[model samples]
Target: MGNHTEVTEFILVSFNGQPQMQIVFLLLFLLMYTITLVGNAGMILITSCDSQLNTPMYYFLKNLSFLDICYSSVITPKAMVSFATGDMAISYNGCATQMFFFSLFGTTEAFFLAVMAYDRFIAVCSPLLYHTIMSKKRCMCLVCISYFFGCVNCCTQTGFTFSLAFCGPTHVNHFFCDVPAVMKASCSDTFVNEMVLLVVCGLIIVTTAIIVLVSYIYIVTTILHIPSGKGRHKAFSTCTSHLMAVSLFFGTVFFMYAQPGAMSSPNQGKVVSIFYTVVIPMLNPIIYSLRNKEVKEALIRQLKRKGFETIMDNCSTASEFILVGFRDLPELQVTFFITFLVLYITTVMGNGGMIAVISADSQLHTPMYYFLKNLSFLDLCYSSAIAPKALVNFFEEKNIISYEGCVAQLMLFTIFVTTEGFLLAVMAYDRFMAICYPLLYPTKMSKKSCNRLVATSYACGCINGVIQTSVSFHLRFCNLSKINHFFCDVPAVMNAATTYTYLNEAVMFSLCNVIIAITTVVIFTSYTYILSTILKIQSAEGRRKAFSTCASHITAVTIFYGTVFFIYAQPAAMSSPAQSKIVSVFYTLVIPMLNPLIYSLRNKDVKAALKRTLGKKRLFSMNR
Candidate 1:
C-alpha cells in the first residue's frame, strides 16, 4: 500500500511460486476442494436421509457441513483461479466481500463446533436430560445465535480492518484477503485496528474454546465414573471426533489471529492458512466418518439402497481385479486424462443430444429415429461403462476394481457393444425394407415387429454378456490380478488368468465369431439387396437419398466392427498390450462420440428434426 488517493483493488501474492510448485499445489488444492465438497455434501445428505442421525449432534453437524462448504468456497475457488491464470488482482469491494463472508462462515463454524461440543457433553454427561436440554426449538435458537455472533464478529474485525486509511493500492501477501494480511498492507496507523482484530479474535476463540474444553472435561469426567469400561469407551468415542475438529479449527484461528502483532511472515502464514481454509474442512467429515459407527452404518445402508448392495454383500478379494491403465506412460498421463475427459463429455453430449432431438420432434417418430434412439442409448452406455473409470485410473497410482466392479463393467460393456452390433444389423434390415420394398415397408416393419426386433437385439446381447462375464470371471487368477487395459475386456481379463483358460478362451472367441458372423450375415444380405434396388432407381436424388440413410449406419458399423474384430477376434495381435489398449479405447470411447455426429451430420431426418425442435422453442419463446 502506498500514499495514493484511493485504493481500487488488491493484488494477491500468495501461491505465486515457481511453475513446478504451482502445478503441484494446484492439483493438491483441486483434490482437497473436491473432497471438501463431496464429503461435506455427503454428511449433509446422510444427516438429512438417515433416521439414525436424527439427534442434536447430526442436526448441528448438517449445518456445520454446509458452513464448511461456504467457508471453503469463499477462498479456495478464487485462489485456484489465481494459480491457474496468474492474474491475482481482486477489486476493492470484492476483497471486502470475500473478507466479510469468509469471516462470517469461519466464525459461525467455530460457534457450531462449540455447540456440538456442548451437545456431546449433554449426551454423555446427562443422558436423561439430553432430549429436554437439546430440543428442536433450543437447537434452532443456538444455531441462530451462532450466526448472529458470526455476523457481529465479522463486522467488527472486517470493518475496523478495512476502515484504516490505505495510502496506496493494497497488495495482499496471502491468497485471500485476511485481516492480518490486509493490516500488513495498510499505510495508515493500524495499531488500533490490529489491537481490535486481536482482541475480537481472542474473545471469540477463548469463548468457543472454553465451551469445547469444559464440555469435554465434563464428558471425560462423567465417562470415567461409569462402572463399565465399555461404557466409558463408548461414551468417550462419541466426543472424539468433535474434540479433534475443535482442536484443528480453534488452534489455527488462535494462531493466526490471537497473537499480539503479526503471527508470522507472509510465506508461513500462507502455508498455515491452507490448513484451516482447505485441509481442515475436507478432513472433518472423513474423521467423523471413520470414528463414528452410526455414520458408517448409515453410509452402508444408503449405498445398499442404491444398488451397491451386491458389492457390499461380498467381503472377499477373490473377485478383485486391478486395471493397469496408463501406468507405464507416466509422462503422458495428464495429456491422456485431458483428452479422454473431453472425449467422454463429447460422447455423452452428442448421444444425449440425438436422443433429445428424436424425442422432441414428432417428425422423428419413424422407424429410423426409433432405431437411432436405441443405438444412441447403447453408445451412451458403452462409453459410460469404460470412460469414467478409465479416466480416473489415468491419474491414480493403483487402478483397482472389485470383483463385482470388474464383472459389472465387463458385463455392461459387452451388453452395450453386442447390442449395438445386432441393432446395426436390424437397422440395415430396416433400410433394406425402406428401399427395396417401400410399399410393404410400413406393414412388414410394423410397430409391433420393430419392438420385437429391438428387444431381440437386447436379448441377444444380454445372453452373450451373461455368458461372457460368467466364463471370463470363473478362471482362476494370480493372487494379485491386473487387467491390462483401461477397463475390463474379455480378452484382457482372460489373459490375466492363472489357470487353464482354453475352454474360456474357446467360448469367448466362438461367441465373438458367432456374434460378428450372425450380425454380418443380416447386414450384408440386407445391404446387398438394398444396393441392387438403389442402383435401379431412375432418379439421382432418389439414389442419393437412399445412400444417405445407409451411409451413417455403414460408417458406424465398419468402424465398430473393425475395432471389435481387431481387438477381440484376432488373438495374435493381443500380445501387444499397448496396441490392444489403444483399440479398446477407440472401440469404446471414440465410437460413441462419432455415432451422434455421424447421424446428425449425414442423415437429413436428424438435422431436420433438430432444426424443427429448435425452431419450435424459438417460436414458443417469441409467443410468450
Candidate 2:
C-alpha cells in the first residue's frame, strides 16, 4: 500500500507572493463572494416571494441559484479565510469533504442548467404541453434526480481520489482540493483515477452541452417560424438571458476542465476557475433580473407592498450607536476635528443661506428653485445627521452612542439622502422641460406639480428610510457593538452584526442599486433630451443662456454622484474603515458645503437675488 501517513494534510498555494497583492486578492475574492451570496440568495427570495414568477423556468432558476450558493460557499469562504490568515493547510478529511461538496454542487449546477434549457425548449416549441410536462411535481422530481446523480458522482469521485496514496509532496497547487490536484500528489499510479475523472467529467459535461445545444436548436427553429416580427422578437428575448448565462457558465467550465490538464497552466486554470465560481454566480441574477421585465415589475411591486412598509413601521430598537469617527488616526484627532468643524460650519451657513434666500425672494419662486430649496434643506439635514456626532466623537475617548440614537441617525440619514437623490432627478426633469419644450414649461411644471414632486420625494425618502433602517437594525448584533465608520450606515452596522447577514446585504444591495439606477436613468434620460434640444437652438445667446442655467446643476450633480459612487458603488470589502471614513467626510460634509457655493457662484440669478436683497436692506436702514 502507498504511504498514506506521510500526507495527512495538504498545503494550498499562496494566493500571491507579495503582501499587498495578497490583500488585493483577499478583497477581490471577498467582494465576489459577497456578490455571489447576495445575488444567488436574492434570486431564491425573489422567486419564492413573487408568485407571478411561479413557473417551471423560475423554479429551475431558484434551484440553480441555491446550487450556485452552495457551490460558491464550498470553496470561496475557505479561500477567503486562507487569504486573510495566510494559512493554506487543509487536513485530509477537510480536503476530502471540500472535494465531495464541490463536486456535488458543481455537477448539480450543470445538470440544472441543462434542465432549464430543456424547459425553455418545451415552452418555446410546445407551449401547450409545457404546463403538463413541467408540472410542479415533475419539476421537483427533476431537481431531486439532479441531486441524486450529483451525490452519486461526487461520492464516487471523492472516494476514488482519497483512496489513492499521497506519499511525498502533499502540496496542492490549486486553491481548492479537486480530483486532478489531489491525483497529482499521489505516489502510486493515478492512471485509473485520471481515467475515471476524465470519463465522468467528460460524460457529464458533454451530455449537458448536447442537451443545451439541441434544445436551443429547436427553440430557435420555433422562434423563427413565428409569423410576426414582434412575436419572434418576444420569443427570442426569453431565451437570450438563459443563453448568455449558459455561455458564461459552460464556456469557462469547459475551458477549465474539459481539456487535458497538461494543456493549461495552473494560472490559467485559476483565472478560469474564478470566472465560473465567483463571477458567473454574481452575474446570473443580474442578467436574469435585468433582461426579464417581469422581474423588474415584480421588484417594483414588492417595494410598494404594504407588508414591506409595515415591517419598517414596527421596528423599535435601542437608543444609540457610538459614532466611531476616525479612531484609526488617534494622533490626528484634533486636526480632523478642526477640519470637520470648519466644514460643518460652512455647510450649515451655505445650506441655511440658500434656504433663506429661496424663501425670501419671490423672484426665485419657480419649479427649479423649489427643487433647489428642497435639495438645500436636504443637505442641511444630511450634514447635521453625521457631522455633529462625528465632531463629538473626535474628542471623546470612548465614542458611545445610545441604541435609539443610532437608529434615529440611520433613519434620518437614509431619508435625507434618498430624498436628495429624488430631488436631483426632479431638478433634471425640470431642466429638461424648460430646455426641451419651453412653450410647455409653464403648463407642465405648475406650482401644484412642483408641490406634488417635493411631497413625493419626501414620501419616498421616508418609506425607503423606514425599510432600510428597519431591516438593518432587525439583524442580531451580538458580535461587535462598535461602529467602524463615522455614522450609522447600513454596511458598517451590517458588518457589526453576528448573525448571517447575506439576506440583509442582499436587500441593501438591491435597494441601493435599484434606487440609484432608477434615479440615474431618469436624470440621464432627461439630460439627453435637454442636450439635444440645446444643440438645436438657433441663436448663440439663447444657447449660451440655456447652458448657463444648467451649468450649476450639472456641476452639483457631478460632484454628488462622483463621491457617492466612489464610496457606495465599490465593494465594501475593498474599502478600509479609514478610507470609508475619509470618503464619507467628503460626501457628507464637504459636498454639502460646496453645493450652495457651486450654484450661487455659477448662476447670475442667485447672485443678483442676493445683491438685490442686500440693496433693499441698505435702503430700509437708511430710511429708518
Candidate 3:
C-alpha cells in the first residue's frame, strides 16, 4: 500500500547450473517424494484397515503421518518442479502461502508430540485412572484443540507477512518461500515480524518440551524404586521411541530457530531443516514400525496374505512367506544368533538365581527383600519379553508376534513395570526405616510387615496391568500396527492406534507426577535421615559399613533416574535423536544389566550367599 508499484512475483535462485546436477536433483527428489508419499500414506491406510490400531494414540499418529505428508508436500513439490523445469520462479503470494502452512504444520506436530509424551507418562505412572483420564471424547477434544491452535498460529504469521508491501527486490534466495527469505525481500520494516515469529515459535517449543521434561522426571523417579532389573527396563522401553522422536525433532528445530540470522548459513540451515523435515519423518515410521515386534508381525501377516493372493493370481501355490532380504546373510545371522543366545542365557541365569536366593533365604525377609524379588521377577519378565523375540528375529528368517501376543506382552510388561516403580519407593522407605530407626527397626518393619508390603506390591501390580490392558484393548487398531522396537512399549503400540490420545496423556501426566513426588519425598527424607545418622557416628568403620550397604542401591537409582529425568524433563526444543538413542539404550539395555551386577558384586551379603550356593553345588558334584 505504501509503494506505487505492485510486487507480484519472486524469482528463486537455483544451485549452480549443471544439466547433470539438475537431472540428479530431479531423480533424487522424485524418488524421495515417492518414498515419503508411500511411507506416510501406507501408514495411514494400514492404520485405517487394521482393527487393532483403533486407539487414541494411533488416532494421533494417523494425523501425524498426514502432517508429515503435508510437510513434505509443501517443500518437495516445489523443489521437484524446480528440478524438472529449471523454472525457479515463485510468486510472492505463493511463497507466503507455502511458508505459512509449512510453519503451521511443523509447529503443530511438535505440540502434538508433546501431547503424546504426556500420554505415555499417564500410561506408565497412573495405571489406575488412565481410562477416566483419557476417555475418547477428551482425546478428540485435544486433537481438535491442537489443530485449531496450529491454524491460529500459522494464520498470524501469514497475515503479518502478507500485509507487508514488497517495493524493492523480488528474489527469494532458497528453493522455497521460507519466512526468513520472504522477510529479506521486504522493503518495509520487518524486524517486528521477525521478532514476533521468534517469540511465538520459541514459546510453543519451550512450553511443550518443559511438559515432556517434567513428565519424564517423575517417570525416572518411579523407575528407580523398582528393585528388579527387568521390570525397570520394560518400563523404560515403552517410552524409548517417543523419547527418541522428541529429542530428534526438538534438537534440530531449536538449532535452526534459536540462533540469529548472521550466525546461520544457508547450507547449514538447509541441513538443519533436512534433519527434522526429511530424515526425522522417514525415521519415525521406521523406528516405530520396523523395530517393533508387534508391528513387524502385523506387516508380515499382511505381506503373507498379499503373497498368497499374488500366487493365486499366477495359478501357483504359496507355501511360505519368508522375509527375503536377509536370507543370504547366513554367516552374519549365525554370529548374531549365537551372540544373543549367550546374552540371553546369562540374563536368565543371573536374574533367576537372584530371585531364587532372595526367596529361599529367610534372613533376607524384609520389605527391602520383597522389593529385590519384584525387581528380579520384573527383570525376568522384561528380558523374556524382549530377548526371545530378538533372538528369534536374529536366527529365524522371519520375525513376527501375533496381535494378541503383542497385546498380552504389552499388558504383562506394563503391569510388572508400573509395579516396579512403586516397589522402588517402598524399598527406599524400608531402607530409611532400617537406617534411621535402627533401634526400633525390628519392631517397625517386622516379618509380618514385610509380607503385607509384598502383597500390596503384587496387588498394585495386578491393578496396573488391568488398567493399561483395558485402555489398550479398547482402542481401535489401525493398519499401521508396526512397532519399532524389540518389545511392545506403550508409544510403539500407541503409534498403531487410531483414536485420539489427549485423555491418555492427561491421566499419564497426573499419575507420573504423583508417583514421582511421593517416591521422591520418601527417598529424600530417608536419605536426609541416613546422612544425619552417619555424620553423628563417632566410629568411622560403622559409618562406612552403613554407607556401603546403600552404595549400590543409590548408584543404581541415580543411573536409572538420571537418564530418565534428562530425557523426559528437557524441552522438546533441546533434545536430538542422537541424544535420545543414547538415553534409550541406557534405560532399556544398559541399566537392566547393570542392576543385577551391582547388587551381586557390591553387597557383601549377596556375594556371601552366591559363594555359599556355588560352594555347595561344587561339593555335591564332588561327592557324586
Clashes of each: 4, 12, 48
Q: Give per-residue CA lDDT, model 1, range 1-624, as digits (tens).
A: 334338888898886653323433553576568768867997999999988898899999999999999989999999888876779899888888999999999999999999999899889988999999999999999999999999998898888877777755568889999989988888878888877887888899889989988988898789889999998888888888888888888888887888863456778788789999998998888778755778867765665566544322333345578888878888999999998999999999999999999988888888888999999999999899988888888767789888788889999999989888888988988898888888977777778777867887786688678768866876556545888888888888887875445546666776787678767866897799989998999999999988887898889889989988887776675678899888877878888999999888867777788888889899999999
- Model 3, range 297-370, lDDT digits (tens) per residue? 45434554555222222222222112221234566667756755776676677778888887766666656666
RMSD of 1: 22.4
**Candidate number that wins on lDDT, 1 or 3:** 1
TM-score of candidate 3 on Cα atoms, chains taken together = 0.49
Top candidate, metric lDDT: 1
Residue-pair clashes, model 3:
48
Candidates sorted by lDDT, best first: 1, 2, 3
Instruction: Give candidate 2's TM-score.
Output: 0.54
Q: Please say which candidate is ahead in lDDT: 2 or 3.
A: 2
Candidate with more favorable, higher TM-score: 1 or 3: 1
Give candidate 1 regions above 4 Å deviation: 1-5, 17-20, 261-264, 304-624
Candidate 2 residue lDDT tens string, 513-607? 75676567668977898889888999999899998888888888888877777655656632477777677788899889998999898778888
